[model samples]
Target chain A: MVVASRKAAYHHKDGEMTETLVKKNMSASRTSAVPNYRGQQVELGRETVGNVRCANPFMVAENVNVFYGDNHAIKDVTLEIGKKEVIALIGPSGCGKSTFLRCLNRMNDSIESARVTGNISLDGGDIYDKTLDPVVLRARVGMVFQKPNPFPKSIYDNVAYGPRIHGLAGDRAELDDIVHRSLERAGLLKEVKDRLDDPGTSLSGGQQQRLCIARTIAVNPEVILMDEPCSALDPIATARIEDLMDELCEDYAIVIVTHSMQQAARVSRRVAYFHLGYLVEVDDTDKVFTNPHHKLTEDYITGRIG
Target chain B: MPNQMTSRARVEAGLSRRKRKEKIFRASGLLATAIGILFLGIFFSTLVAKGASAFVQTYLLLDVELTAETIAPGGELDLEYADFDGLVRTALRNNFPELSGRNDRRELNRLLSVGAGFQVRDLVVANPDLIGTTQEIWVPAASNVDMLMKGNIDATVDESLRNLSDRQIRWIDTLDQAGRVDLRLNKALFTNGDSREPELAGIRGAMMGSFFMLVVTIALAFPVGVAAAIYLEEFAPKNRWSDLVEVNINNLAAVPSIVFGLLGLAVFINWMGLPRSAPLVGGLVLALLTLPVIIIASRAAIKAVPPSIREAALGLGASKMQVVFHHVMPLAMPGMLTGAIIGMSRALGESAPLLMIGMIAFIVDVPGGFTDPATALPVQIYLWADSPERAFAERTSAAIIVLLAFLLLMNLAAVILRRRMERRW
Candidate 1:
């Protein structure tokens, strides 16, 4: 938490008078048995979500803020997603975790009223610049939605959409190979080996999610964004998708937004906790779950408040 | 739980009452459906009964001694001087030797159609040997005589009110008894074009007109309507201008068909110099009539494509155009085709706009092309309906069967297309 140290040092130099004031207000509010965070002026951490940093980062998001028309949905949050790592963004519903994840790939651009102000870079090249097309950016950085939305096409075409769109495959054999490799990586090849001509919607929920994962990776993207990819699935299906996510991390940096704390602890190497449109705390997954650095993070992890 | 239980008799009564109500509801529903089917059955049965006679024709047998004097009056086969009409008259006279006066002979001559003379002329021109020797031949009886033979006319009615004289009916009955008159299935009814002689008229010209007109209408309206719908539903930004266009399209669908005919008359015929009664103009007018319906249907179909599909395609780097054409359009096709079928059925049965565009013209030649002067099936029906001939009334019903058949085939094609192309997501 480098931001926390810089803010702490600045606050320590200026806190001689306000420290006494804060202490007096803290005692005054505590007399009522409910701590008044506003009156006591509790210090907040300016750290990135998941304080773990990589020496070679694939993508870095800086000072990302999002607004939906009149509503401020995401605050200034900075985070770096490392290559070949699984980072889970866990928070209660409407806490800007999904919004922050959407901002990473400029998925926010689809909403007419959504306004995003941020600097997101892939290999240090600005993704928001006018010259780079969104079509190309999305090809390099793919996303999987919570509800599986397979195109009204055959199973083979679903995995082949990305490669076909980008013209990544040279011929039918190459395209078939890409589809095979993608489905194999998603762990869906064996069950669907014979029925690739069947509709993609014919799959079970977990299988559909895996198919979506296969579709995303068929483009060979460097980063994969998953917005609660297993939320619509059963526990068993959810576990299978989680396992698939674990395997996918070896090839691509993945940012997943999840509601399950146990899922974050089990699958992600790092976890970032969000609250009220702010990045409250981030650290190693075990540290954030067992001993959070921020009071909000601790409340969320222990089920005291969400 | 024991206290909550109803008495056995009361429970049985309640159950029976509910069952009775359901039975009444089902009976009423069945009765409604049966009434509709009964009406359709009566209409089709009556139509088939009346129109069945139009498919058969009656012929009169004639014998004549043809020599050089009757055919080639000057030595060579001279069609201009050939006494084909006189030869037919002499043949009728020979059949009824009791006929003496010119008035009686003229009444007897009326039994043969005016076209009989042309048949003889053609026979002599084709083979002069036929003119030099007597040969028995069967020629189409006059329309009234044909109707009398077919039992279409009331023989008991007085001769003054009927189209035939008592003597003429006697001659027809005698010919029938002697097996000299025959009722054969009229292949000419399917092959020939409109004629003042009702016995010779057929629906071929009208069927061709309808085919050409529908081709033009569908070719013009389907793609344009679908494109307009895609732009309006998927690409158009929300604003007053687009809203106005949408409102106008809805309004256009409700306008009278005859008004489109008027538009075709004024614009396509007068301003554009297109031929009146041409299927090209009539089809353009019908396309105008159908375009809004197609657009409205296509828009609903496009809207039926789920937003999730759009998001999924976009999420995978598919462009907006790809999302629409590759995903949205295919998903929406069955519904769009269903709408187009509805519009085409309406167009197939439409007559008012065709009338306004002069499609009620009595086209004599089967339409060779779209620009030829033509009459669609329904307009042909209208023209036949207004004619005073009894055979035309039967022919009108026949034309209705043809129109309805075309509509059915079109609807079946649409259903097949939908079933073949439909994609379930």
Candidate 2:
């Protein structure tokens, strides 16, 4: 009820101006929106707006900073991911949304120059503790990259790779069961049921992305982090992956980093907006879209700033 | 409108010059390629022209009376300690009865190869029952006579200038006219080992030596080089130590191969007490010479594998070792094999390193094992080329042809294996 009232008040105060600005920006040139918004003298917020807490927080990151050599790639940011909810991180390029997502699985450890300092915990256990192996952490917190990088192996092997490495299955039959279930959950089993022996690279772009997701989920990770998973896919494939993400939220806490506002709005329950490596707003997806309290989030949502 | 028209005209004016430049560049490239091919054609034609005659050998058919009295010298048929040379001399004397003087008989005997006695002994040993009867045997002629029969020696030259005297030439002509002289396929060249007699010399020993040395080279260099490449390319931390190692590896490839021979001479021969002139020592030296090449090639191949594949495997929770062995190694195998084959071919053709280890010695027996004293194909060519005999020149060219053929075959195998492996991806 409070979100509805706030959204209505926002519509009444700036509805006409925002509509005109959007229309003019779409019809005229892109440069005009910046000047019109600058005339408003909008103040960019330093701290996060809206509620950052969830009813059931399971994975939490606090004061995370990442540096790649001398470059500060990701600044201090804090957020919480609920146990069974989809949180989409939306920002412009180089805004640290992807970097933050990589931090969850410690994928940045592969970069020789990258150093991460933060308190990130899964189930109240520190993920970056020396005793906890990155390999073990990655098995529990899986990732999908921007590009569909399937191993140069058969589709069955691609899905079975994680389970075999983590020893999730005891025998061939159990491994086959895991592979089939993962492929079925990713919605690719029916399409590739007959040709499991075919190379994963033989699949189309969307199918390859789905294969990658199946590969990630084969280990039964508790959280699946997707770094712009649907960016490389067409609209139809993107919609399928978005729908898959929606269904996947019921079982796994999914943290997706995306550039498309519509994708974040369509698939996520809560949305976090990052601006220049800072978490400017974290709120319900509907609230962030209609009534973002931070001016930078609003400017980005209305296409005034990328 | 006028400015647009001028811009269009200017671009049109520049287009012809650009096209002319492109044409000139293409023509120069084609010209360079033509020059290379022309040089290769000349080289191969000269090699073939010089080496083709060595395939056929001239022989003299002699009527030998293998009497028990002469061959056995007893009532019992004794094959060993036989006077086979006397039988050849007696056959030659019967053919030219007019040459009764010591000088004439000696000149007559020079028409036959020194290997003729060995040939007669082999025949008599194979057929001991024919000891009491006369047999017609075709034995190899002397190198000079063979050269004259092959038209390599100018018979019109003064007898003093040529190795063959006028009497020997006249006897050859008489024998040729009587249908007793023939040109047969040179089976002895492939069957026998090295000898002072050019007509009796063969490259079988060198071929076997090369085979054993290459076996040792590949067995030692390939795995070690590829392992080093994998460790450096995949697992090693990027630090000053690794950088220094990388620089040293690249420098090792540029080191003269003979220096590796010296190292092997000191370390493997003198220090380890391995016998000199053995294929094992030669192979070890060549392995050192080839390791840098294989490592460089393997590193390049491993580097060529897209980082995405590594990332994909790593993201799947595969350990670094698993990621490399399962994905990176298989994908880089074709290129690694190509590099190894190229290195092996280079080792096959290398003679400098083997020379320092005493593989340049004159080996008369086919190498039965790696430890046997032997000479590689290139070393054999080097040895034959250094000889003063006119026939050794043709043998040198023939050995070169054999070496080139082996190199071609190895390269062809590399191409075929690469194609087969690449199709899996």
Candidate 3:
């Protein structure tokens, strides 16, 4: 039965490839169309791939299904997250994009009657391991929220919060250094250094968003998952964060879930487009934006549908 | 266009009705304000007319020689002793040197207070050097003299019941003319502790007792009430047990304060055999009465804390406990303190429960500790107000003033704390 299921998964992949070819040719406009490459190999040979490797290709998804009371939120969808890459999960409202993000760090556990199923693993390592503390796992995989939420505490404390929780600093001086470096990486240190003790909430919306990024980076997570982190900020804050993401790629694998197609194009090296709990297409960011392979992906990239 | 015109007419009709209703409401509000002001005016005037004369006390000062031979006439024996009454009478007679052959001195002696002797004895013992020395002592006059000083005495009374003889009355007249016998304002009437003598009794002890009791109430109730509120409002599940607990808390708040006093009588005093009339027992009872009020108010305050703050804390990797204690508690503090102050103020004015548990009048010395027998301000007022002695009327009024002052202080504290903790969001 296991072998049969494995074979079925491969067949599903082949069928998806054929659908990609059909979608690219059928698109009315390139603006709305993700150009589908039929039989065109994505040569992730030398330059595209990196030194980082995932321990296992087979992502074990155990009984993972979500429900909001009688309403079935996310179906029993299973997928693997590969190392040294980006995976963007997209869906319309109530399709469970945020729910899935919460499940990654057991953030869903806080919500009442919001049940989750299926065990998602990173390199076959049980993320929901019995001995694994959620706080520790959260430290390993940091998340950036949709809204810019900074503590009423000082700007320095806002960035240093995660580091303090994880005991990442040797002393006050070291913690201060970490806060400085993280803020610098987020492109906010220069603007806020003179008033380090000023409340983080006192900053502009864009600065607050950058402060949140600086906070996430202070803990030094292996994977950074952003959930529409730029949605609440102005276009300038959004652009600055996108540029920060480009700079972050060398040190950590970044997975960003964004509503803006232009933002995905500007920031991500690679992009995986999702539609209704299915990975429609995965390719270079430029190709996915200028030319999508799936019908839904193309429709979404343009103004046709989301 | 016809439908639009009809809809506009309907809107106009609704607006006209609303305006008419507003007029009626304003008229009724004015009536209510007049009624409220009338009631307050009546209350103030009634209290002033009935209570004003109680502030002044009639006193007699005389040079009483404290000779050990006269005090201990028979000399030393078994227990310690002093003839304080003999000393007081001799001092009064000595002050009136012309009363040697007259029987008016006996009737005139009745004008002195019962505790006047105790006052002289205490003074002599305190300053032993005055044992053989002549000391001018000031002591409260009798209740009759107090009435006479306040002009409450009727000169046309029936001869059979008229206690003061014409000669003694003449001496009183002479004293009055000399300005040695006059009604002076008594500061200690509101500031001193209770004593057996009506003249010596004051609300100060009961005030301290109530103050200390309220301190204990705030210390115990604030933390427990806020913790319970936080747990119930923020973290506890909406199961049957928690729901039942919530219901019980509401019901407990409505239970009569006397019921809690009874509980204290049984559990704290009888069962535990704690000292009766102690402020600790009284405080514990009042705390029980105030706890439910505090819990309900704190829960409302905690509920008023926006969920966004909790989300913000949780998203920052703070645990569930941290989210509440750090963010939620600080935001809810001002409201909690206000609730606590109000609850404590309510507890202070309560008399029935304190009366039920022997807090009526532990009249002696001031309370030295929690275990010491003490009366609360309201309880002292109740005792004085119930006394048959007409002189106690003034003391009762004075007690009410003290109680009112304390309530004002607590309310002021609530306002200041509420303002201090006010936040923008």
- Residue B142 displacement in candidate 1 (angstroms): 2.1
Q: Give the residue spans of candidate 3 off by over 4 A.
A: A1-63, A80-89, A255-261, A269-306, B1-14, B26-56, B63-84, B94-103, B121-137, B151-173, B185-187, B190-192, B422-425
Please report, in order, the local distance difference test score of every candidate based on alpha carbons.
0.82, 0.87, 0.73
Clashes of 3: 11
Candidate numbers sorted by lDDT from highest down: 2, 1, 3
Q: Candidate 1's residue-wise lDDT over B107-161, tens digit each?
A: 8888887767776776777887675788787777788998887777888998788
Per-residue CA lDDT of model 2 for A1-306, tens digit only, reads: 213323433555533323333223222321121211234534434356888888999899987767665445665678899998999999877788998998998888888877777689998999999999889988989889899999888999999999988889999999999999999999999999999999999999999999999999999989999999999999999999998998888899999998888888889999998865667789999999989887778877887424
Per-residue alpha-carbon lDDT of candidate 3 for residues A246-272, written as tens digits (9 for 90 to 100): 788667766778777777777776665
* Winner by lDDT: 2
In the order shown, the candidates' Cα RMSDs to the true structure are 7.6, 8.6, 8.5
Query: Model 1, stretches more than 4 Å misplaced?
Result: A1-57, A69-72, A75-77, A275-278, A293-301, A304-306, B1-28, B63-94, B116-138
Instruction: TM-score each candidate.
Output: 0.85, 0.91, 0.81
